[model samples]
Target: MSHNVLITGGSGYLGGDLLARMGAANLPPYRKLYASVRTAEQADGVRQYGAEPLFFNLKDESEIRTTVIDREITVVFYLIDAVQYEPPLFFIQALSEVKKATGRTVHFLHTTGAKLFSSHADAPTDRPLLDTDPQLYEIQKSQNPKLNVAREGVRTNCAVVEQAEKYGVRGYVFVPCIVYGKSKGFGEPVSTLRQIYMIVRAAKTLGRVYRVDSARPEWPVCHIADNTAAYIELLRKILTDENPSHGKNGYYLASSGSIAWDDLYDAIAAALVKRGVIADGSVTLASEKNVEDMGTALGVPKEMVPVQLGGKCTLSARRAREELGWKPAYPAEHILEAADGEVEWVLEHLRD
Candidate 1:
């Protein structure tokens, strides 16, 4: 494997999983794997996964060009906001340099969340959302009051996929739903699991469970390991498929199953009772309108509530499975199966 791989956000929840999974595979995936970290502290953490941590800043296009083009990096994995046109379209410029230097197709994996279609709806959609689903899109052009957002994430994601050819890169946007389960990599799983952690912690601290006033919303979910498996298989395809039919036109979504918000709340409530976190076994449903302040209502920290809480946020990884041969081993119905371990872990690793 002469492919040099560069993974941005290597110390993040998803990026850590990618590095750890690649390292644990039967055969080493990349001949040279560089894990790009924003800080020196994260660089040390990435080294544990056998990846040479490069303190690379996406804002620094010249350095990125040197890394991707000069170092001949064939695969670039963006676990964070690499799709954004801001920071001066750094990724496109970097890949353009690669194509100018070498005519080879530089595989770029950009991650975007299912929140693109997430809404404040009361019910989940009957079917999973496709990449091209217009009704489900967050941005609606024709409505009286258009659903145009100022800083839309899906906009950047779409731009990368639509403009990849012009920039000389094979772009694939990975859109995953609410991700859970134990992370395989060394870095702490922060962003995706923060809500659940807060819920569990707040319940235990307050001795009561909480739910929102909104109608039960469905949330698409995938385990961390299963999500990582999808990435691994996608990379394998990028490496082996010389002229794959999928080409640069594929947008991959990873979703094992969908769980209703009420059900998840019950599961957490049950887990709390079983774990002795909540006494008297009572659940308290909260109102979003009544309490503008989460701290006043539940004593939980104000870390912007995830849109998945709004419901109808379902997605299908069917495209990814069919195209990349991705088969998620984790069960969506059994996501709370890891609740026990997660509870203990979060309690022990609780940080402000």
Candidate 2:
């Protein structure tokens, strides 16, 4: 079977991992693998991994549809956040139209974070959400977050699946947690974990870090390399496996562990203290005043602290393991080990 893969956000951490892994001959052979990048510099980034870089502005839905249709690209891995929803909606709509005009199944895997049934604030627990679990998957949108853009991402995946059922456009959704790792190809920071940047900055500015809610909110997390492997495994199966291209079979989770963002902050603070930058090796939590004053110095706004370090959100990868034989090599028990590498990278790049 001939396959041509097109990955959006190829210059990004996850996509760069895919590109580098492909370059390393990790995934099955494809006729061509093109990485869609916006800038010339971004294009150069993917070129190192031997991907044919395609420069196309994704905001223009017509352009995106044209490129997909023109190239006859069989598979697409969309890593961009649906913070901008219209382009993605339009892109999927065009694929649906293509299926209507000519019967061709284009497999699309979209990345949406595991904030779907989250901000389930009033009730917090140690139980991790499983994709096989109906409760979480059943609730698509939530009224919890006033500005719930992530909910819209889930809706987008739903719409794409509906189109697949109606017009035969194959679609899948991948929900990943806070991904940690420096990219193998470009060494770019995983932008999803803004907490890493904030914590490091807090340590630098105040010689310590702050934690709220006692630093014990379990949150879903994954290493960059492991998450990338899950993506590739799913991509490989979508093409070769007998899997249908809609609904839960099309959805996956890419998390191996959970740790409170507060705990992660503690590690960062301890690292700084051990380096003699901070006076003590402990986390401090003053009033919101501390965050407000340090916000100016550290570029972290005070009001955003609570939202960034909110309630616990855990996920289970059981279905991915049972179905695709995927397991996160770096489980929650070992997140600190990965954090050691991450802290070293953050200190060298972010705090420097």
Candidate 3:
């Protein structure tokens, strides 16, 4: 069946990269491409990439249904921040309806973060957690994150899978780790880089870089291009009806490998010191008061400071490699090598 695809968050870092690369992806034949947009300028922005801009209230179930059913969008790539269940449920149900009406398969790829499978969310940190593990869904279902927001995110991941299964739609949980490097899109091409940004913000306030965790914890990392490539590969599989794994086993982590958080902190610190953003390049352990000050700088609660900047997330990438034949062009330590450029770009674009 010819498939029409809709990509939401088309102006975001990941979404914009997807649109930017779509022209060169050499993807399998599909009917049409649509990008969810909010303004005339954004609509024009997506049009540059050969996408029909779709304007609809994602929160309104009826509007979402109308938009999807009318456009006959058989595939959706949801890249927006979705810690709640309602929006994704709306899309899944709408896609299921499309499947029923036309007797064609529909797919939903929900973009979630690596944090949902991290220590912050109470995911196991004792070993490398493979995305292809048969028990991954159950593990996600059992997570009781200490942070209320993270807990919601974990639940949302489970809800997407369960709801998609109930509605007979293919669901994929696309996980992007600590993705770095510059974006290649027409819109705002900067990643939020929340963790790195927090460190910089806190350092500026405290005059030095501070370590949120004493024992260096590791987290998965990915380059922007490699991350976008993984998404494209999965889309290729779907378009070709390869059935690249869906439902509970559809978790795809787009990461080269894992890196120590301390290594990242040190690299950024060196760059910041060279630019005089921080007085000292040396990384120091965060005292209680330091944590509080950092929280104030970040405008988050003190308890959430570590959750934002530190903690181990050993969620490994296996499914993307084994199933989609995806490989990262950048290695695990490439983020460290690119830290100088990353700091320069981030400093230029970061706003208070």
In angstroms, give how far residue 293 of model 2 lies from its true place: 3.7
1 or 2, which is superior by lDDT? 2
Task: State the C-alpha lDDT per candidate.
Answer: 0.65, 0.67, 0.90
**Deviating ranges (above 4 Å) for candidate 1:** 27-30, 39-41, 82-84, 120-127, 132-151, 189-193, 201-207, 242-248, 289-291, 295-308
* Per-prediction TM-score to the true structure, in the order listed: 0.84, 0.87, 0.98
- The TM-score leader among the candidates is 3
TM-score (C-alpha) between model 1 and the true structure: 0.84
lDDT of 3 by residue, 1-352 (tens): 4899999988888899989998999999999999999999999989999999999987889999999999889999999875877899999999999999998899999999998999999999998899999999999999998888898899899999999999999999999988887778767656664577677777777888889898989999999899999999999999999998999999999999999999999999999999988877999899999999999988989999998889999899999999899988999999999998888887887777
Q: Cα RMSD (Å) between model 1 and the true structure? A: 3.9
All models, RMSD in angstroms: 3.9, 2.9, 1.0
lDDT of 1 by residue, 124-199 (tens): 3455556545333333222121233313564565566656766767777777777776676667765534456766
Q: Which pairs in model 3 have colliding backbones?
A: none
Better of 1 and 3 by TM-score: 3
Best by lDDT: 3
**Candidate 2 residue-wise lDDT, 1-352, digit = tens:** 5566788887776777777886553566667778888888888888888778897878887788887777767677888764455665656666666555556566777777765535533222455557666544344532234444544555665665565556455777787777777777563664534556656666677667777554466677788788888887787776674463345456677877677766777677777776776787777664677767656655546655554545567566666777778877887656666666766777767643
